[model samples]
Target: MPELRTERLLLRAWQPADLAPWAAMNADPEVRRYFPEVLTREQSEASVARFQADLDERGWGWWAVEVRATGEFIGFTGLDPVDEDMPFTGVEAGWRLTRSAWGHGYATEAARAALTFGFTTLGLPEIVAVTTATNLRSQAVMRRLGMACDPADDFDDPDVPDGPLRRCVVYRISAGTALS
Candidate 1:
């Protein structure tokens, strides 16, 4: 996909040279706290490769986010389809950033752009966001984006081991009301 530029970030595809920084971000315990595990260098490279391929084939994937002024990559954000049997079938918006980029409204900005792409360019009616129950920061971002929590729509994430974090919370926003 083409690069998306925000006031402070450039969201674009990953390059091979991004492996080291991507791996370092993955290795940061704080950054990986919500994920099951920190990805190794090889895994990071593979992930980036897959993301690149997905963008090439589908025209949408998690694009790398970089600082606009310095061109320093910070992390990624994009739209992803939830697996089959998910409560919602449409695309879902998501994001992740390095510790250095946290609390700067970058996640909200990048995610808004992704959601716009999903609802406008992709013509999706609604987009959902799922995260561990304990991931309050992400949940808060969803709310800030005008998504509503559907307590009745909670689900157990088979990908995550059974635990508090495994019981996922879902947030949703329709294209008509995303900016409300």
Candidate 2:
């Protein structure tokens, strides 16, 4: 995927040098709350490889979110495919950032750019975003992006391990809407 430049962020593919900070963010408990487990360094490397491969195949995925001014990798926010059966069969918008990047509106900014790519570049009719019930922060970002929570679309994530956090709330945003 080609790099996407926002006013303050550079959304692009991951690099080998992003491993340390990326792994650190994945391993952080605060940031990993919605994830089943903290990812190890090896897991993080493998995940980055998968992200790159997905981008190669589909032209987009959870892109590497970076600070344009300092050239620092913060985290990622972009579009990805969901394996679950749902209202839409296309891609979904999503984002994740390190603790330091929280409360900075990076998620909304990067995600809006991703939505533009999904609707304009990929020609997707709509995009979806799912989060655990406790993930109000991400949900708020979704709302700010003009995505509406579809209570009827809520379901337990088939991909989530059998546990307490399996239930999720799904949000939907159609293309050509007033999103952003």
Candidate 3:
């Protein structure tokens, strides 16, 4: 898989060493707050395996994000195919970081790299991001990346069981609208 470098983070292929930390990130209630539930270690490991497979086959997917200077596995940031069951169809940009990695602009920086790749190298016309409507943290990151939300795009996620998280907002940025 191709590796992406920013000012500090490296978006690269998942390594065996990243597994434990990735699992921890998945299991953290705070980190998983926007999702339905925290993941088990086995589920986390399976996610890494799937991420690696996507990277190996497509040359891009959710990447293990590491701090360049310290080589610490903080989390993941990259492009993913929007869930097939969603009302929309397109690539999506996403990020998840360890609590320690929050508030450092890492998500924005790393996600910018991912969006750049989707718009330029992959030639995708547009990329979208979805999060629970109440997930202001991620919504803020989307805004930082110059993505805009159309109220009309909001919808109840078909895949989510009944809960607060079912209502989601979709933020979109076309190639022409993406930041340089």
Candidate 4:
């Protein structure tokens, strides 16, 4: 799989060393605030397995993100086919970071790299980002990556239980408007 590098972060394939910190991040309440619930170690490991398989197959998918400076595993950011169960279909850009990594523009930086790969490398015509309506931090990062929100594209995710995370918002960026 192709490894992506930004000024301060690396978007690379998963390593055995990443498992511990990845589980810790998934178990973190703050880190999982937008999701249905925190994940168990088994769930986290299974997710890594799935992500790695996709990467191996297509050469691109969710990547383990790390700080290039200290080699600290921060989180993940990359492109994935929108879940088959979703109301929509297209590639989506996403990122998750450890709580300590927030407010540092790393999400935007890493996401921008993902978006670039989607638009240029994969020749995708558009990429969308979906998040809970309440996840303003991720929305902000989407906006920074030049993605625009259209209320018409928003929908309540059928998979999420009726709650704070059910209402979803989607931000979109077409290849034409993508920023390098």
TM-score of each: 0.95, 0.93, 0.98, 0.98
Q: What would the per-residue lDDT of candidate 4 be over residues 1-180, giving only the tens digit for each residue? A: 899999999999999999999999999999999999999999999999999999999999999999999999999999999989888899999999999999999999999999999888999999999999999999999998899999998899998999989999999999999843
Which pairs clash (backbone N, Cα, C closer than 3 Å) in model 3? none
| Candidate 1 residue lDDT tens string, 1-180 | 678888888889887667778989998989988878888888888889888988998989889988899888899999887888665687788988899999999999999989888887888889999888889999999998889998998888887876676788899999899745
The local lDDT score (0 to 100) that residue 68 gets in candidate 3 is 97
Q: Which ten residues in a row have the lowest lDDT in candidate 2?
A: 83-92
Residue pairs in candidate 2 whose N, alpha carbon or C atoms collide under 3 angstroms: none
Q: C-alpha displacement of 118 in model 3, angstroms?
A: 0.7
Off by over 4 Å in 1: 85-87
Off-target runs (Cα >4 Å) in candidate 4 are: none
How many pairs of residues collide in model 4? 0
Model 3 lDDT tens row, 39-112: 99999999999999999999999999999999999999999998888899999999999999999999999999
Query: What is the Å distance of residue 77 in model 1 from its true position?
Result: 0.1
Residues 50-155, candidate 2, lDDT per residue (tens digit)? 9989888877888999999999999988888876565346677888899999998999999989998888888888888988988899999999999999788777
Off by over 4 Å in 3: none
- Higher-ranked by TM-score: 2 or 3: 3
Most lDDT-accurate candidate: 3
User: What's the CA error at residue 52 for candidate 3, in Å?
Assistant: 0.2
